[model samples]
Target: MRVTVLGTGAMGAGVAQSLLREGHEVTVWNRSPERAAPLGGHGATVATDAATAVERAEVVLLTLFDTDAVVDVLEQAAGDAPTDAVWVQCSTVGVEGTETVVQLAEKYGITLVEAMMLGTKAPAEQGKLTMLAAGPAEVLERIDPVLRAIGAKTVRAGARVGDGTALKLAANAWIASITAATGQSLAVARALGIDPALFLQAIDGTASDSAYAHTKGESMLAGEYSAQFALDGLRKDIGLITDSARATGVSTTLLDALGRVYADASAAGHGSDDIAAVGTAFTKD
Candidate 1:
């Protein structure tokens, strides 16, 4: 597959590398050339612009930040890309944004698959991410090789373009909730002069145990805030989650509160750090 990946940020870069490892001809572009430049050494052809990147692409993956970035890049590159090429929309741009993407695909006559990724940088780098996909059976079958190169599993949300986006938002709502809840428990334990490690110990073999707790909890304990998934990125996703929840009458009470915690963490200069930095919100004076 000749794959072109736009927006080579942390996640996007990993996705590109994973494709390269699978022996696909990969072309990458980023607004900041330096980010994409690194992939050149790893067997990816770094394009000078989005338009050039998709000219020979068999599949174009939009791994950009938000709806606006995705829209901007697609508009710039659509004319140059093959109409038969599959555009895998992998950004977590919520349900409303997916509708906009669907319209763009129609306007340009491009085949689109709404495929939102699950898992952070590590999973993306290892080709272990779960892909929540929604599109026609034939289109998905056509891009199965591309999907296999980037994800460990492809979960079919439905045939409708927005179905994958809806499922992605629901899954992200749980991610934000559990990460915040884990941070709170750890913070409260230390505040009460209890060993936070003991909290992990207590839940080690219980029904309440979660692998994610230990992943983020240990990072919080060590204050190693290097981003696997940046706090600000999760903050953006939380806002999308709240908006989707409110629209569906799903009660944004918990999500709204969690959003505030992430907002505070971002405001406190931890925006570029790991989501474990949310623990600071509970401990701050």
Candidate 2:
């Protein structure tokens, strides 16, 4: 498979490397061209421009920061990619943006596959991402190798543009809620003079314990929120979930509250830090 990957940030760059490892010819393009350079060591062809990257590729993956970036890059690549080339959108643009991007696909006459990845940097590098995909079966069939190389498992959410993004929003809302809950539990333990380690021992192997709680809780206790996933990105996902929930009449009570907590963390200058730094929100002013 010949693949063109746009947006070579941590996640995108990792994904491009995964495709190259699978022995697919990969072309990578980023707004900042320097970010795409590191992939060259792995035999990736660095494109001078986005359009040049898409020109000869059978598959194009979009891992940009948001809907607008995806739109801008796709508009630049639209005319160059073949009509039958499957354009897999792996970014998390919420419901409204999903609709607009679907229109953009029609405008460009490319097969659009809404495939949202469920893991961050590490998983992308390891090729363990769960692909929550939605598109025509014919389209997916044409690009199965590309999706399989990027994700360990490919789940077909449904055959619509917004279906996969909707699932991603709900999943991220739960992630935000649980991540906040994990931090609060750690804070409560500290207030009571209980070692957070002891608290984990109490919940260990119980139904109340989850791998996320354990992993992120350890990071919180150690005061290490390195950017596996940045706080600002989580804030963006939270806001996207809240916006979608409101438009669909789903109560935003929990989602909005978590959004504020992440907002506070961002305001406190931890936006570049990992979301595990959410623990800081509880202890700081």
Candidate 3:
């Protein structure tokens, strides 16, 4: 497959590397060309412009920050995409945003698939993330091998544009809510002189154990703030979840509260740190 990956950020670069390892011809483009440097040595061609990146690719993958960024890139590449090419949207945009992308792709006669991933950069680079996919059945089948190369599992949400986005938002809401609760509980435990490790062990012993909890708990205990996923990015995802829930007349009090915590973390200068740094927001010396 000739693949073009837009927005060469952490996840984008990971996606590109995964595809390259699978023997696909990969082209990478970022608004800041400097960001594409790490991918260049990995057999990826860096595109000087967005349009040039999409011109020759059979599949275009988007892993941008938000809906607006996705739109901006697509608009810039409007004239360069081949009519039969498939546009795989792997960003974590909300329901409305996904719908808009569907419309734009239809207008341009491009096959569009909403593909939202369910893990961070490490898993992405290892081709071990889970993909929530929704779009035309044939299109999904056509891209199954490429998706499988980059994800451990590909769950078909439905054959509709926004279904995958909706599922991703719902999954992220659980992630944000659970992470917030874990951070607050750990803060209380530490203040009461309970060892963080002991608390984590007990929690992992129960049904409450989860991958996010374990990973983030270990990071909290070690004070490792590496940006596997950044605070601001998680904040944006939480906002998208809450907004989508509200638009659909669903209640999301827990997600709303988590969004506040993320916003506070961002405002307190931890925005660039890993999202697990949310623990620092509640910790008191």
Tens-digit lDDT track for model 2 on 1-285?
Answer: 999999998889989988988989999999998899989988999999999999988989999999999999988989998777889999988988888899998987878988898888888988888899998888888889988898999989999877899889888887788889999988988888988778777889998888888888889989888788888998999888889888879899998779888888888988998888887888844
Q: In candidate 3, which residue pairs get closer than 3 Å at backbone N, Cα or C atoms, i.e. clash?
A: none
Model 3's lDDT to the true fold? 0.87
Q: RMSD for all candidates, in order, please.
A: 0.9, 1.0, 1.2
Q: Residue 119 lDDT in model 3?
A: 88
Q: 1-285 in candidate 3: lDDT tens per residue?
A: 998999888898888899999999999999999999779999999999999999998989999998899899988996798878889999987877888888888777778997888988898899888999999899998888789889999999999888898889888877777777778878888888988678788877688788778888888889888998888999988888888778878888877778888888788888998888888778655
Candidate lDDT scores, in order, read 0.92, 0.88, 0.87
lDDT score of residue 234 within candidate 3: 91
Q: Can you tell me which runs of candidate 2 are displaced by over 4 Å? A: none
**Could you give the candidate ranking by TM-score, starting with the highest?**
1, 2, 3
Candidate that would win on lDDT: 1
Per-residue error at 239 for model 1, in Å?
A: 0.8
Off by over 4 Å in 1: none
Residue pairs whose backbone atoms clash in candidate 2: none
TM-score of each: 0.98, 0.98, 0.97
